[model samples]
Target chain A: MSTILLIEQILNGLQFGVMLFLMAAGLTLIFGVMGLINLAHGSLYMIGAFAAAAVAGWSGNFLLALIASLIAAAIFGVIVEMTVIRRLYKRDHLDQVLATFALILIFSEATRWTFGSFPLFLDIPAVLKGTVILPGGIEYSLYRLTIILIGLAVALGLYLLISKTRVGMRIRAGENDREMIGALGVDISVLYTMVFALGAALAGLSGALVGAIQSVEVGMGEPVLILAFVVIVIGGIGSIRGALAGAILVGLTDTLGRTLLPVLFSSFMDGSAATTVGSALASMLIYILMAGVLIFKPTGLFGSA
Target chain B: MISKNAKRTVKALGAATALALSLGQVAVADGHAGKLKVGMLTTLTGGGAGLGVDIRDGFLLAIEQSGNAGIEVVVEDDQRKPDIAVQVADKMIQSEKVDILTGIVFSNLALAVAPSATAQGKFYISPNAGPAQLAGRGCHENYFNVAWQNDGPHEAAGATANKMGIKKAFIWAPNYPAGQDALTGFKRTFEGEVAQEVFTKLGQTDYAAEIAQMRASDADGIFFFAPGGMGISFLKQYADSGVDLPLVGPAFSFDQTILPAVGAAAEGVLNTAQWAPDLDNDASRAFVESFKEAYGRIPSIYAQQGFDTGLLIASAATKADVKDADAFRAALREADFTSTRGDFKFGNNQHPIQDFWVRKVIQLDDGTFINTAVEVALEDRQDVYATECALDW
Candidate 1:
């Protein structure tokens, strides 16, 4: 790969990593503090994309559409947490998984019923539609670059919310000792709801951002949900920092593996064999990375235990 | 005494109703000699539901128009899973005792059910998916594919690329049986140097890595066989990636069902299909009109295939008894129906031998995108695998 191409691929990897982190952050928060596995996080992502598309269609304003996604997903998150998710936190992991998995089906079917079976269009705004040449004559998509900046902004904002703020301090305490935080006169349930909503809004934001480029369809959330799970698991189940690190690692591995492996194999094997072997290996690269991480650090890169 | 009397009356009523039901069944069976029980195992729910819904609606529309009460259709959702498709096929075969099986959307699901369904003397009429194995090595006498072979459109895409004067091409498909068939078919006829041939993971939504590679490859044109949502992602991302190369592919990406979803990104792309809405034929015009009238939307390529499958069954039903396997097979081989695509016939492999037309995607005044026929890609096209098919009549 040329240096310029390599730089672009790295940017691509970073962009992908940040997107995963958006999903992973919320996932780690819920799993870390609430000790609740939220499989429907992906559903929230879908909700955001659909909401953005609906709003964008009506308003013709991209910024308004994005804000609508955040608000819509947050509202849905609050409702879901209050009505269904609250019941599962006290239950076993199996029960939680079953209930959340059911939520996924319900969300998918309901969305399909509402939106119809076809995918909806959500194009990138004109201002961010084309590419811009970076320093040293490297051309990159302006929208994707915006996505990276937005993701990093969210990450930094999340850090501030979790560390500097009182709620963040309470969250840390809850992660350390849930009962102790409750004893400290914190309204633990309300805190849980806030954290869940925050995570959900982040997921929705990422969804609306990526949805501009990808498809806005039912079951679109499921794949990203699976990747978020991988991201959290690799990053350490409840650590935002680990989620970021792990997400970047995964994004880089996947993008670079896909681009480079086939070329590397084509050097030795025939064109067809190289592509087959390389791509097969490339798809498995993330899982292999996960396994390797677990082998080395069973508690993930950031887990305390 | 009153309770006992009521019980006795209820028993008498139940017996009378049971006898009448049995007699009614016998009468209906006697009424139509060429009656067919068709079992439709299709994707009715989940990600691929749009295609399945089209197939089911179009087929039923044809049946409804034919005024054929003799064709009793029983439908079941496969949910787009191969194992579920197999289970449903078994249920339809063993319990429903359907004489014919049809309406599988994906090749993986079709391959799972068609072989076993055909082996058990159930006639399998393929409407959408036409895998290469069933056309060549595993060609069954009872299996009749009313749709084009899996690679038929891709082959036409190759020819279209040639016509477009694209000398070097970057071709890609998801790494699976049909995907492999697509790339292989594209290379079969195109007189071009392959800039790159990439096999992506099935259901992969992101194409930045591949798009980047495409920009770097300096290919004259690009041919991609990403069907359904995958195609939408590729189109949107490619349009945004600043790579302004002309895109060419088969019609799966540019069909009525998804073209609207793809929106302006797909406009003006040349794609190949066996059928187009603007085909100058009575049946084709009628189908396009009635389909829109019935469904409140334009019929997709899959729907056209479904209508033809239904028509094929109806025409064959008039001539031969469905219970008689040899006679029914022979009649199906004749392919006596006015297909929405003009001049449809079956090759030796029992797949469609029809003209492949190139269609340019154009947006309507209402801002919805659809394809119109521009030129013929291949005349009276036969699947390349037909010669290998050893099914002797």
Candidate 2:
């Protein structure tokens, strides 16, 4: 492969990595602060997509749909937290996993019941529907570039909120010691609810933003959920910074490996053989990356070790 | 002693009267003495729900049109799991005592339940998933496919491609059995070099790298076999990437199930299928109009197959007096029905030997787009690998 093609593949990887970060950041935050394994995180992603589609359909305004997704996802998170999630705080991880898994079933069926089985299409907002010329003579999708920008903004905003705000302080405190914060009369339950909602809203936003380029449908959250889990595991169980690093690492490896491996193999192998071997190896690249991390860093590069 | 005997007689009469009334009510509810039990196994509530919902509705419409006569259809969700398929099939066989077991979308699920139905000697009417094994040597007397084999439609695509004089083609499909079948069928007719063959994960959302590879190869055409949501995702991405190659696929990817998701992106895409909304026949026209009027949506090939399976069951029941499993199996072998696809009959292997059509997507006058301009019976399509099938046919 030429230098230009290699560079282009790297950019593709970066874009994919950024998308994963948007999904992983929310997942890690929820797990880190709440100490709950929320399997319905992907469901919230579906909710965002649905909310955006419905609003965009009604108002014919893309911006309004985007805002509606965030608000709707957060509202949904609060309601779920209040009714079902609140009862499971002291339960074991097994119970948490079961309950959240049940939530996935409920959410997926309800979404299907409401939306029917057909996938809803989200139009890329008209202004951002074209391509952009990049450095190294690469022509990237403007919509994809927009996703990277939005993801960066959200990452920065999340970092500041956790480090700067009073709620952030309470969250940090809750993360370190839940009982101590509750004993101090800080309304620990309410703080937990807020943290869960915030995490959900981030997940929702990610869903809405990505839904434009992809599809909004029942079970849309699942593939992303698995990827996000991989991200958090590699990033550390409860670390946002680790999520970012891990997600990007995953995205780049996945995209670049898929594009480059075949071409690289072709130099030594016949065309068809190279392609079969390359695609097979590419699919396994992420797991290999995960394994390498586990062996070397165990807790992830940015995670506490 | 005589007065006590009179009281006992009166109580017995009253109890008898109550039992008669309840039995009368149940008989009226059933509408007949010989209530035909039809078991419908479909994915009622999951990712595959959309197509399943359509199939379920079509089957119901067929029942409703038949005046809800002769058949008592019991619908259950398989949840797209093979274990669930076996459990549901067992429940239908042993508990529900269904005279006929029908309806499935995936081939794996069909494979799971097909043997059990045959072993029990019940007529197994397949609405979908015509795996090649059953078409050839694995075929059973009790197993009857209302739908064509998975390879049938792709065989039509291959014939069409051959006729169109397409030289080089690239194949991209999900890394699954169905995908392999599609590629194998397509290559059977099209005697050309495969520019590229890429196997993607099932339900893969991102197609950027794959699309990039296709663009680089600069193939004349690409054939894909992704069904349901994956088709929508791929088509949308393909549209965005601005790849100028002609795209073709089987009905599952481009039919009514995915048209809404692909929307404008679906225009000009070609597909090979057995059933389309615009088939030029009175039976097909009536079925399509009624289906659209009832469901407020177009009927997919899955739905058509589902409806046909129900009708086939009804026909077989009337012929065999459904109470007799052996007779029903014999009737299924005869396989006479006025399917939405016009005249239909089963091959010796018990799979539908039917016509396949090449279709193109275009906008309708109602401002909605559908598959219009259907080319009929392209090359008298049948599974190319049927020779491998050791079916008793």
Candidate 3:
């Protein structure tokens, strides 16, 4: 309940939010641009973590591992888009969901086939191994702080990419009218492939970064994927700005609720009972936030009506 | 090689990959009138696969090593669901005609299956998941738990906490039934002030907020009991958070199954267990050596539990006729097998009466992680619930 502890919890929430944004941004972009409901986005994230872990183990270089994650995810994303997702775009959301859901099963089993069921080891590089004292006298994980910075940088970079770049313009245009862009001599298929790869790469990078702190294992992506979906829903699906906003909001709400609710309940209730009740409620907090947002805006904070 | 032993398990995983990844490797059917048929219904898919797979591998390995053609095992995956466990238990008893039922890695599933299995007069020798009721007032004479009761590790952890001189402690667990039991069990024996007790969401991977609270609070130690993936996440985060509080926990988190994933973060942490890989005994040493050679990984206590169950069955099968129900039950009750965990006997409730050891997580020179025996925490410990069990012998 101390101010310093509260500050640290807030930072933790921000870090968690940024991680979700990394997943949500790609999901929103894919949905916005192609109208494809990609449930396998989490699979790409899992692939990123596995690739990072494998590379990191082989060369003993975290940087190389990080690079490998992005490359691997992008390559896989492109391959999947060309092979399967390219067809689903013309079909309904149900078909896309069913196909992508199948991809999740394939990816999870294939990853398990490759990595085995035991969790793989991945740690933050030695330089970022421990905590750092923030300006407000709060001791925070250096790795987490790095993740927050990376996430914000990605957000800003994405803003510039979409607004200032030609490719970004094409993507925005494609979102408005896919057939029109194709008729205007832009290879919509190539644009779609590139966009999908970019989205996959973002998800992969998030997975690798988070995998260093958490476990690199099968089904790891799923829980985060649900939260990421919540983020995009709250922020507005297909909107990068919405995804970022929604991710941070969800992250802060979830983390702060988990930390403070028990203390809040302990004020009136006993400790054990308070912890039980608080945590049970805390698990529902994000979904509550999502429901509240959807009730009001329907299209989300940044999503179009 | 980390994957050398994994090759055997990987084959089993490959076997499971085909059937929607729920059922385990079904054995070749060869029913004999005299041989004991054991139904090993356990979780082989979903999140709980690791524990179940380990149990199956260990049980099968022991059966293979004994070269005992007298015992046949039929393995099924309960999918970690209570309904599925019940359904599978019925199948094993009715259709498969397994004379003895075992290999459930969870308590709820055990609670779902054991009462019915024992009521049907099929012997259920548990490899893991000894719920309190099965060891207490609800104890069935036909059910035998080779592993310790549900609160065994926690009760021993409380005792070890006292021995280690921890004065004030922070406790954390997932909000679930077993998690609640863990808290009550720890506090039952602990003679210390509670700095804080926190229950996290089940399946939660991040523990940053809780770590911050631990650092800020006036606690001397931390006690946690998050199993499988959740534990790995917490240990890694706890290490990086720069908190120096000594930790005491049950072996579920620090077992060989996950220590490799947790890495150096878990080094030197103390956990309570009924057996350690480095236990000094003939059966214990032999089991460890062969388990590593057979599986290419260190056997967690889950595997040890399965191995012990196998031995217990083999001993009984050799001593008395399975056709003679009373004789077989008495022979099994004699508990004559040389256990991997030292000085094992069954209390009146048919749960294990054995020593609980304090194991310290240490990285071997070979870079694999294992829990080596540090000290005897509780010698010849018996569960307090045996007196409450009203089953007449």
Candidate 4:
């Protein structure tokens, strides 16, 4: 394989990884603060994409779509939190899982009913419509590059929000001692709702950004949700830094393995056999990495030990 | 206490929505003289719902246009799950006692349901899926496919590629029976060296790695068969990546329902299909006009197949005694219906021997994408698997 091709593949991996981070960040935050497993987190992602597509179609403005996605997801998140999730907080994990799973079905059906079965179109903005020549003379999509930058900025912003702000302090306090924080002057219920909405807005932003490059349709969030779960699990369930690390790790492994495995196998075997084996192994590469990581560090790369 | 009351209200609302959604599926009976019961099972609420919705809509439109008071349709959502499809099929056969079974869109779901349905002496007139196995040794006398065989469009693509003189081509498909069949079909007719054959995970959204590999390959042309959202994602990403190669594929990817979502990414892409909205035939024109009037959008190939299924059934019902299985089956074999596609006939295997056209995606004046037939690629093509069938006439 050419060095340039390898470099391009890595960039693709990085782009994929960063997007996963956007999803993982929210999931990890919700879990960290609320001590609740939100299985319907992916539904929020779908809501965001639909909101973006709807806004983009009406106004033909990418900026408006982005804002709409965030606002819609946040409002929806808060409503879900208030109506259903708050009730599940004192319940057991099994109940939480079942309730959220029901939410998935409801959200999926409702989205289909509202938008119709066909995918909605969400276009790349005019300014970021083409490719750019990187340093190695490799042409890359400017839109994909923007996604990477946006993900990084969001990650940094999340870090600042958690470590440098009063809301962040309260979130940390809640994570460590929910009862104690509630005993203190902080309105823990409102704090929980805000935290959930913030996480949802992040998910919505990711959905809108990715929706431009992919189809905006129902059940788009399920695949990403599974990956985000893997990211958070690998990163150390509650750590933003861990989510980033785990996401990049999973992304690079998946991308590079998929690209290089067939070529490597073909050198030692026949073409068709090599391809069959290589692709099979490549699909499992990330899960294999996760298994390996768990064997070595049960808490994940950055999870609390 | 107030918050608890609010929670109860919310719970009630959720329950009401669920109840209403389920209630929507309950079939309404319209009293008619002749009895022809059809159980329409198709994906209605998942990723593959677009194609299924088209099929259901077209099938219903045909039934409506016929004003066949004898026909009672029982529509159910399969949710694209094979197990669920089997359960629904069983209910239709045993409980509903529908005379005709149709409106299955996926080959996997069809494979799971068709065999059992046909074995029970129920006629399965497929609206969309035409698995090769069913055309070969698995073929039954009672089973009929209104659509082209699964491999038909892909073989047309291969012929088109050969005509275009593509020396080296890279092919990609999702890893499944249909996907494998697509590649095999393409290779059967194409006289060119395959640079690469990539089988991706079904429903894989991201294709960056695969695209990178394709870009680095020395292939002059590319062909892929990714339906629904997968196709939408792949086309968009491939366009964004700026890999300027001649792209060709089966019409599933560039169909009318998905073409708008694919947008300019699908422009100039060649696809092969047995039906296009622009086909110059009376039946085609009427079906298109009526379908548009009913559905407010251009019909896809799946919809065409559904309409054809309805036509086939309606024609057979009119001519033969549908109450007699033998007469109905024989009449269906005569292929007396006026197909939306001009000059349609059935092969010995009961699949359509239809003309496959080379279609190019073009944007209309109203800024919507539709496929226009550029040329006829294959004429009256029968699937290769037809010779394998041992069915006695």
Candidate 5:
């Protein structure tokens, strides 16, 4: 209705898109290099949330919790990669899916066993608890603004790590020709482990950051996992840039659609009818966007053909 | 064999009547020879397990408090599926021969099992999942609910919201029967403009988009009807969205099961329900304390309802003079028990005619969250279809 409200909605969409990007980056990387459809990726996200909650509870500090969550998730990822994931790497996609599905059960049950089926609370630090006034007289949560900034930083950092580093070179090589990379005596097994750990760490970081805004619980990683899958599929599988682009795209579409669709519908219909139609359409907006993108550019906006 | 069966039935009925009068903890156990077979079905492993576990914990604690009776509760995981619940119900009835069927966390499961219990002539006292359809047109004689009907609490919230002069409100719920019942129940009481009536995905985690939409809407309050993990996730996101709108919901959102998960985000949220841990009564206090002592957590409404289910069935068995399912069903319809919800009696529809209270989450002296401090008592809360419930008696 108002310019200010529209601007606020757009900002909200951008923040949501960035959060999706954080989740999509790791999943795309794992899928690109490992050629394994890891269904248990959400479990790693849960691991990060639990780790953050535990560390934050212990130290009474948020920064320590964030660092600890990433490290803890990375360690757990490497351990899982070595033990269960490695066994399925050479196996078929069906086997990998089943194995990872089992991991989800194991992870969820284990977390429930430890946490006793209660959700843990992660607080936003006092510094980021208030609202900030934005341009156009719009108000926004400081914590969400921080997420957008942190998400951008993560994107930049990931870009540098993948494009500039020696490990990045090997990862790119591995993605192109895994057999040749292993044949060149680069300890491909260790490389795979590290890559998995890196993805896990990123997922963990996202979980920790997002946990402050959502309830940290046993299966919290799952919905995010689905969104990340959409992101990668939209951006182009195994493409970081594609993931980033696609995540933002999906996020903005989802947020904006939900906010504006009802208003759009209300123009012709009554309020109640508009709301019912609007909300239903809003829920389907992202998948519709994905379908449209697929129709035109099948590999995704940034995915390699 | 007919004479012997008749005598056993008379004896069970006599015990049930005496037990209600006697106020004995272990009221009726003579009917089930030695092995007290109890089948407990709840959502145990998946998303809805949060509520299921609470119900399970309550049932187990009641058994423990009753000195871990001669009864063996064979727990089955329903996973919140109606079809799975039916299978579990069949197994409990046919194979396990569970003298009592209790502990259902969702209404769909309750509906599936309630009809079957009536057909099979077993006493099915539901701890939770008071479905609307059953409370009205399809009301069963054998099926009894320890919990209030699904509409009861939400109706209280809606009434309270209207009284507070909250003119413009937003209603959000999952797309299901219970969700429909919740919003409908709320709208029945709250005569206000509903800015948006949205149905979210069943297991939706992110509320950013919805929250943003609400921010732009003209609504003064947001009413939500998400339970278990869904409630926890939605509440946390709603809090973080920086909308200063007052939040109100049913007791399901801020119960002992989900309070810990949402933590401080749940603080100051108002809810309407039949049971709170801090209800001003000796029975409620004792139940809460004993439950906490056993489970290392506060007892939720789920637990209270589950415990009530056990008590209801046992009391029924004592009254009916028969340990068999038919006698117990008859006795349960009599509905003679003083429950944790305080002086609740069964209506003709076999649903609870109980008081719904407005409850708020306040920090206890131990720095833990609780739905304490009852504000108002909405008595005899029933469904919109209560008029449709036709009973002979």
Candidate 6:
């Protein structure tokens, strides 16, 4: 393989990793603050894509669509938090899982009803429509590059929000002790709602950005949601820093493994057999990594004992 | 005394109603003119729902146009699962006692359900999902396919690619039976070395890794079979990746239902199919116009197959009594129906022998992508596996 190709593949991995971070961050935050496993997080991602598609179709403005996605997902998230998710806060993990799983079905069916069975269109803006020539003369999609940048910016912004702000301080306290924070005169319910909405908005942003490249359709979020779950589990659930690290790790492993394994296997065996084995192994690479990590660090890379 | 007497009267009334209902069922089943219960089993949820929805709409449209009052259709969602399809087929066959079964959009599901239905002596008129196994040694007397075999369009694509003299090409497909058949069919006629043949996960959305590999390959052209969202994702990503190779595939990738979602990325791509909306035939034009009016979207090839199946069944019902298995099978074998695809005929294997057209995705003045028939690629094409069928009836 060419050095240029390797560099490009690495970039692809990084791009994929950052997107996972966007998804994992929200999931970890919700899990950390409320101890609620929200399986419907992916549904929020779908909602964001649908919202962006609808808004872009009507307004023909990418900025407006992005704003619409965030607001729509955030409002929906808050409503879900208030109505259903709040009820599951004191319940066992099984009830939380079942309730959120039901949300996924409800959201998917409702989206299908509204958008019809066909996929909705979300175009990359004109400015980001083409490729950019990197220093090594390798061409990369500008839109994808933009996604990486946006993801990194969001990561940084999340760090700032968590470490430097009063709301962030309250969140940290709540994560440490929910009842203690409530006893200390903080409106714990409102804090949980805001945190849920924030996580949802982050998911929405990722969806809107990724939806331009991928087909915006129903059930589009489940695959990414699974990956995000892996990211959190590996990164140590509820750690944004860990989520970022794990996302990038999983992304690079997946992307590079898919590209390189076949080439490596082809050297020893026939081309077709090598490719079959290589691709199969490549898809399993992430899970293997997760397994390896869990074997050593049972709580994840940053999780508490 | 009053309560006991009331209970006895109620018991008598209930028994009488049960007797009447059973008698009514028998009356409806005994060659009743309009009582043909058809089970429409298709994917109506998840990723494959679009194709199923189209098939359902077209099938229903044809049924409505026929004004067949006795054709009571029972629709069920299979969710694109083979197990679910088999269960639904059983329910329809046993509980609902549907005389005719139709509307399965995927080959895997059809393979699971069609054989069992045919074994029970029920007429299995397939609107879509023509697996090669059923067209060959597995062919049964009671089963008839309204659509072409799974590899029909792919074979045409291969022939077209060879005719265009493309020497080296890269091929990709989802990793499944249909995907494997697609590559095999493409290679049958295209006498060129494949740069690479990659099998991706069925519902994989991101293609950056695949596209990057394709970009680096020394291939002159590309052919892929990624239906539904997979196609949309791959085409859009390929367009953005600055790969300028000529791309070709079966029409499933670039059909009307998905073309709008694919947008500008799909333009100039060539695909092969047995039918297109612009095909100049009375049935084709009428079906397209009415489909748009009914569904507000141009019908995909799945819908055309469904419509044709409806027409085929309706014509057969008029000629033969469905209650008589021999007569119904004979009437259906006559192939006396107007098809959206002109010159449709049934081969010995009960699969369609039809012309396949090479269609290029063209953007109209209103900025909608539609497949325009560029040329007839293969005329009166019959599946290669059809000769293996030993069924004489």
Q: Give the residue spans of candidate 2 off by over 4 A.
A: A1-5, A183-185, A257-292, A295-298, B1-35, B163-165
**Model 2 docking tier (incorrect/acceptable/medium/high):** incorrect
For residues B163-243, write the lDDT of model 2, one tens digit per residue: 666678888777655776788788877776788877776667888777767766747888888888788878877777766
lDDT of 2 by residue, A18-111 (tens): 8888778877787777767777888899999999988988888999999999999999999999998888867655566667777877888688
Residue B42's lDDT in candidate 6: 84
lDDT tens readout by residue for model 6, A232-304: 8788877889999999999999999988998899999997778778888888999899999988986688876
Cα error of candidate 5 at position A221, Å: 1.8
Name the best candidate (by DockQ).
Answer: 3
Residue B64, model 5: Cα distance from true site in angstroms? 4.0
Relative to the true structure, candidate 4 reaches a TM of 0.93
For model 1, which pairs clash?
none
Candidate order (TM-score): 1, 4, 6, 3, 2, 5
Q: Between the candidate structures 1 and 4, which one is better when assessed by DockQ?
A: 4
lDDT for each candidate structure: 0.86, 0.77, 0.86, 0.86, 0.78, 0.85
* TM-score per model over all chains: 0.93, 0.89, 0.91, 0.93, 0.89, 0.92
lDDT of 3 at A60: 86
Once superposed on the true structure, which residue ranges of model 1 sit more than 4 Å away at CA?
Answer: B1-35
Deviation of model 5 at B74, angstroms: 2.0
From the highest DockQ down, the ranking of the candidates is 3, 4, 1, 6, 5, 2
Fnat score for model 6: 0.50
Q: lDDT by residue for model 4 over A1-305, one digit each (tens)?
A: 99989999999999999999988899889877886667678889999999999999999999999999999999999999999999987775556766887788888879977998899999899989879999979988899999999999998998899999999999999988889989998999999999999989989999999999888887788778878877877887777899999999888988899878988999999977787788888888988898899789877888776
Model 5 per-residue lDDT tens digits across residues A21-140: 878888788878887667677778888888999989888899999999899889989999999999987775566766776777788878888976777878888888868888666778
lDDT accuracy of residue A155 in candidate 1:
91
Using DockQ as the yardstick, the better of models 4 and 5 is: 4
Number of backbone-clashing residue pairs for each candidate, in the order shown = 0, 6, 2, 1, 14, 2
